[model samples]
Target: MLVLTRKTNEAITIGEDIEITILSIHGDQVKIGINAPKKIDIHRKEVFIAIKEENHEAVKTVSLDSLKNFIRKS
Candidate 1:
């Protein structure tokens, strides 16, 4: 992992479009702001993981339904 230290109001840029900045720091909690094009997606790690798992479950349900339909037709 690439780690860097940034103080309040400091920012780091990614590629040509994304920029992440430190907005504030209160004890252990840090607030950040991100600037990016609307086409880009940004999600918290937990939220992203939940979405991935939901998609996987949906695919499994679809496959099971397909198999059942195939068996019924046979």
Candidate 2:
């Protein structure tokens, strides 16, 4: 994990494209802005983890035999 300290308006660049900038600091919460191409995906850590878990569950619940039965019924 990379830990960096940045003041307001200071930015850290990733690769040649993405930029993360410190916007404001209020109490213990710090606000940051991210700049990247539209093709890039950005998500909060918790949200990303939730999405990954949902995808894993979906894959686990899928069965070829069940799919075949459904197709036959249709």
Candidate 3:
């Protein structure tokens, strides 16, 4: 992993369009802002992990064909 040090108001660009900036700091907590194309999505690590886990569990409980069948009935 590439570790970087940035202070408030500092920003780092990714590839071309994505930019991540340090917006504020309070104690040990830091607020960040991201600028990216509408096609790109950004998620916090914990939230992403949680969503992945949930999706895994959901897939185990239901199949794509079953979901399509339900959607057709609706």
Best candidate according to lDDT: 2
lDDT of 2 by residue, 1-74 (tens): 99998999999999999999999999999999999999999999999999999999998998999989999999
Local lDDT at 33 for model 2: 98
Off by over 4 Å in 1: 64-74
**Model 3 lowest lDDT segment of ten:** 39-48
User: If scored against the real structure, what TM-score would every candidate get?
Assistant: 0.83, 0.83, 0.77
Clashing pairs in 3: none
lDDT of each: 0.95, 0.97, 0.95
Runs in model 3 lying further than 4 Å from the true structure:
63-74
lDDT of 3 by residue, 1-74 (tens): 99999999999999999999999999999999999999986888999999999999988999889999999999
Model 1, range 1-74, lDDT digits (tens) per residue? 88999999999999999999999999999999999999888999999999999999888778777889999999
* Displacement of the residue 39 alpha carbon in candidate 2, Å: 1.2
lDDT of 1 at 47: 98
Worst 10-residue lDDT window, candidate 1? 58-67
RMSD to the native, candidate 2?
3.1
lDDT of 3 at 49: 97
Model 1 clash pairs are none
RMSD of each: 4.3, 3.1, 2.9
